[model samples]
Target: MGGFFGAALKRDCVEDVFFGTDYHSHLGTRRGGMAFYSPENGFQRGIHSIENSPFRTKFEKELAGMSGNIGIGCISDTDPQPILLRSKLGRIAVCNIGIINNAEELCNEFYDSRLASFETMTSSKVNSSAIIGALIAQKDSFAEGIRYAQERVEGTMSLLILTEDGIIAARDKFGRLPIVIGESEDGYCVSFESFAFQKLGYKTRRELLPAEIVRITADKIEVLGEGNPDALRICTFLWTYYGYPNSVYEGVTVETMRTRNGEIMAEYDIQNGTLPDVDYVCGVPDSGVPHAIGYANRSGIPFARPFIKYTPTWPRSFMPQSQEMRNKVAKMKLIPVHELIEGKKLLFVDDSIVRGTQMRETVEFLYENGAKEVHMRSACPPIMFGCKYLNFSRSTSELDLIARRIIHEYEGEEGVKYIREYSDSKTERGKRLRDEICRRLKLTSLEFQFLDGTVKAVGLPECKLCTYCWSGKQD
Candidate 1:
């Protein structure tokens, strides 16, 4: 859960690099960084903490100062990226998107071989810089270096290297993360998410094929080597959880799909006669806000933000593992506006209901603030399955909540029958089950983000996305 954007431009690319990377601020809050190469400057790197500050504010001073033709930048969730490294290969700057699961083993291997010592950050992992540097040191060529890094890592990684000669963009072999190329009058841009491209007046050149590596210079963008195209595995969770609405992956637009999801939820509300007489419809926060906008537009209601996010504190989307800490953090991060909620029957849309503990507390706080009634709508169905691919980072278990407990009671056994109801949101039994679950959550009403609606919301053909978290399907 971090994102990066890099570019090799025909003209000075400092503005594109800074703003493109800033577009990914929603992805990570720990650190923001940028590095660039110029014949005179060699490699320049800048890092800032966005925890108490925003990327724009923190990097304002560096924007004009860090000018170059080729550069790389990152919004890092775990550690600062765009790490400038001096190795036998060359002086290079590295940035990554996606996680490396085998950091410990690789770190130890580097240490045992007396190759390098990694710098530890607040997160306690071997610096991603050191890991990428180790890979660079192991190979003779940039392509080989990336291939070595992709082949050895367990999880996903889409990376960019700004070397003394040129820039290299590489995606993980599985392509569990996304990387795309953009072309402008200036030069070429490489990024993990496409949202950055549109704002910069750049058009997508092409998506970097899975396990593909390409090196770019002022003259041309060249494919270095192919990792493995047939290993066409992409993470399924991007649609449901982490990705932004404007970003595109696998030829699908996130905003269109989420809007479709909103339309479907509106229809379902009408069919069930659960539509409430609400003054305004609002989303829980950011993720839920898009769908709420669609819902309000379709349902002909005002879309309001009853609770303003306390961004100063609760800015990060996913937190480190700790329930007590997360709960406290969540509470401190949101402030309810009594003026909006008081005497109003509010319909609130959210991305998903995980454990529902945080949500329950949130709703109760709304009521205490004088909300006449609070109706709940979820963009996606209940998460009966814990994500196997993602760190999830929020809740550890699928069964640690009301949905799983109710399913257990209904089946009296955790077997095929119980699992089937949880997946089928349209089944009469499924409807009854969700109704009961909603009653328990103390929501006046609740509607799951349907599987079809979710697919449409993601704007992807059925074959591209991994719906395993919702349907219990495994690839």
Candidate 2:
């Protein structure tokens, strides 16, 4: 997953575009790019790797030569973008924030038809944004081309394009990702996160519906096409884990929803007589704090920080490319508080236990520091399948997930038929799954927020949300 921002302003929009794109740094870590268009300079673009440094630090040097009234920028985990392309639609700077699963097939089709050829990157793959441009060029106008490109792409795609006239913004077809407009004194800006613009002294204009397309100028936002709200399937992970605390999507704030989710989980535990006796209720840092706070408030357990993540050296969302390094760095970031962990019965609420690598390390570290018992609460249900839409889980295979691994061990290929049962604690199979995970992780107890409970916490009709990672169902 990634994010982008664009500004068409009365004055030079360099600063606005720079900070707005930088505000989305949490979305990706691979590459950062920006493209600007001015009457004098025409179009100027820059792309740099952000694996070692942050978005702001890496892009700040380019600010001297970059200036424009209209610009588009993005933070991407895959290919470099805000790519400068000249086509029938004109020279437009484009960048995308979603996955395109069928790239190879589409590229092969393009090659076979002899319509056009594609340029591959260092990874020996075509840039997704470039492929989008090719698809859009197949039609006559930008609106029709946009609709066409979206229909062809197998996965999610939300994009920002910088043209001489202004900027064109389009949300993904199924609305798996969100795009919002913000109004300021100078002009309007577009972003995936509402907070990104609000912090830039811009007022909330409106959020684009699923598959909507719009063109933004300094004064007005013209709707190029309307979106279908009936087919809405916005990603649920945005609320539970990926989204920033201040971020809001589908009219619900992330922090508010997380707090509410924890409250709902506590209510369920209380009703089921499963609320554990713990000396302290602790959150697994960062995203988990709000959930833990809500759990603590509802269950009347004293909330404490038994261990803190040393984020100064390693940013909360900063990820290394390799899994081996990720596990090593994750362990190095924890700084335990002996006063809080010594002889304490700790119950930790985490955003989600995907691979359970970090959680296992954390629980083991606590026991080493003298904790009597370590219980765990996952804010979301066990992920049954790799995310097909947003690629949020980053799992190359289902075996990469701890839940899937357990299912494979017990039932082999037969486990695929009972994913729902394995996800539910009420089922005997689900109970067995929990016991096995607890034993492996060296935990005293374990529980996950049920699928229905999570939807209830989100306060959205089930038909409108995407729970593919957990339920293996699409809207």
Candidate 3:
């Protein structure tokens, strides 16, 4: 995954551009880049290979002597972005977030046509920069080109383009990703994540609609096109894993949704008679931290980071391809802080447990440090079905993980047939399924966020989100 930030300002926007882009460091670990357009200089692009370090430290030297009235930046997991392209329309810098599912087919068609040539970077299938360039080259007008691109692309995209005249922001047609605008005295800012506006004193403007395109300059802002008001397909997984705590994608804060999820989980526990009175609440580091905070606030318990992250060795959250290496790295990254765990009945809040291998190690670590009993709470229910839309490459096969292990033991040879039932929230079968899962994991108790609670917490109607991972439903 990657994130982008762009701004058009009255004053030089280099500092704002630099720091705003730096705030999206956690989204991707491979590359950090920025492109600026100044009155004097046409367009300047800066990229830093940040595989081993933070974006701030890696791009600090690149910040010197780089100034522009309008600029765009990206933290790329796959390819370098803010690619400067010279086309029929003119030179424009482009940055995009989201995956293109039909990339191979499109790339093959383009190659066969002999009308366009793609240059620069390739990973997985089609290169991101090349795809954006191809999209831009497909039409006569910048707006029309991007519109066609949004229409033709199979997957999600949230893009920002900086030209000599102004900057344009466009969201994907299905709205699988998020894009929001911010404003300050200097100018208007557009970012994939709202956290970019934190220290810059930029106030929140309205979020861009799915497939909407808008142009921004220092003195003017215009909507080139508005998104379809009734489009019903926004990615629901954003609430569970992708979004920042301070960020609100569709009018719901991640923190608030997480709190509601915890409450729902607690309710499920009450109905099932599995609620345990623990000394305190704790979370696995990073993403789980926010959910744990929400749980503690709701349950009136102290929230602690008993398992503190050793980020120096394990800087990135999403691991590289090797499974054996990733498992080892996950344990090394979280060293147990025994001070919080010693002789305490702790409840651990986590986003979700896909493969319980790493979590089992974590629980053992807690016991070794003198934890009397450890209870587990997950924000969302068990991921019974494998995610088909996004590149959820962490757990390769569903059968190799915890969900499958429990399901198989409970339903015998025909367990896979009952995956949909296990994911359902209201059904008595779903409740029993969760209990069996808890027993298998050797937890004091376990509960999952109800499907209704998750949808309500996200603030989007149930129709918009992709609950395929849980319910096996697809749009």
Best by lDDT: 2
Q: List the candidate numbers ranked by lDDT, top first.
A: 2, 3, 1
Q: lDDT, candidate 1, residue 231? A: 63
As a whole number from 0 to 100, the lDDT of residue 65 in candidate 3 is 71
Estimate, for each residue in 257-358, the C-alpha lDDT of model 3 and write its tens digit: 777776666666667666678888887776777777767776667878787788875676454446677677777777777778899999998888887777
TM-score for each predicted model, relative to the true structure:
0.84, 0.99, 0.90
Quick one: best TM-score, which candidate?
A: 2
Clashing pairs in 3: none
lDDT of 2: 0.90
Listed per model in order, the count of residue pairs whose N, CA or C atoms clash below 3 Å is 2, 0, 0
Q: What is the C-alpha RMSD of each candidate to the true structure, in Å?
A: 3.7, 0.9, 2.9
For residues 1-475, write the lDDT of model 1, one tens digit per residue.
Answer: 7888888887888888899999988788678999998887678889988766788888888777777799988998767788878788877888786667788889988889998887787667677767977877899888778788877877667788888767888887766778888888877888888879888988888887788999987667899986565565566456555788777888877666566677778877778776778999998777788778878887888889889878655575345346777777776677888799889999998888877877887788888888888888888866777655444444455567567767877776644366666656667768776788677767887778777777666665556556656677665
| lDDT values, one for every candidate | 0.77, 0.90, 0.78
Ten-residue segment with the worst summed lDDT in candidate 1? 388-397
Evaluated at residue 445, the lDDT of candidate 2 is: 96
Put down candidate 2 lDDT per residue, 122-143, tens digits, no spaces.
7899999889998999999999
